[model samples]
Target: MALPSADQTGNMAEMEMQWAVKAMHHAETYMQLLKAVGGKNFKLTPIDDELYSDFKRNFPDLNIAVLNDDDFKTDMAKAKWREFINKYENRVTDFNFGSLLRIDCTGDYSEDNTMFVMRTQFYCIEIARNKEGLNDSHHS
Candidate 1:
């Protein structure tokens, strides 16, 4: 495969960095929000209850209480997420664009455990987690 020019490589790096910063900021803001108002009381939207139920219905095997990549790394998962993510595409901008998600929610979002996922996937999982008080200990 042809390699990118130096300028292209530089631009790619900058873009990646920008994505990371923005994604991390999203996670940080969520943590702060959770801290500001206990996770159980925090709602990402007026439809949080519906979102939580939908997520569970879509991924019955997913253990939001404790996260792991196994539930989301299979071919079936890719197809499942593709369908699940598309359900909100019209309502949420950049719904399928990549966002960083911590595989282990009990800790911070870091390169070590982070996985790239669609923005809506992040919201779906996170909103449910927060509502369930599973992500209450992030410490912002």
Candidate 2:
């Protein structure tokens, strides 16, 4: 379905909410990949330090604060959110991680309608032995 027009400023807040839900789905896919590979027992190598440094330099305009909590409440938060979204969008386009599984949204102009989209990335990594069988244990 077509996305709502960008001119609908009155619905910006709702649009932002929809964006957040979509971002969370992206995060969820990461979490699920961790689980499928062996849950907490798996060890992901730290993202390459040099690559991360380059990431910072190459995407100076991208905001990394979305990964932090305090930035979410500040007045500049919207810029940060946009940066975060742009970063992953670029990641999908660059094929740096894995694949963009989906980006789905709903609603046209109705208050009751909502929109959602998701992008997925996959990576191949060595899975450490499930020493604790943590996957089987329940934690609160």
Scored by lDDT, model 1 comes in at 0.76
User: Candidate 1 at residue 71, lDDT?
Assistant: 69
Question: What overall lDDT, based on C-alpha atoms, would model 2 receive against the true structure?
Answer: 0.36
Off by over 4 Å in 2: 1-11, 38-50, 56-140
Q: Report the lDDT tens digits of candidate 2 across residue range 1-140.
A: 87766675456788677766655565455446544654454333343333344445644543332223233335685465345446555434333332222111111112232222222112111111122232322211
The residue-by-residue lDDT of candidate 1 on 1-140, one tens digit each, is 99889877775767888987888888778767766776777666556677678888887778766567766778988888888878887776678878777777787666787787888888788887776667777534
Question: Model 2, clash count?
Answer: 0
Which pairs, if any, clash in model 1? none
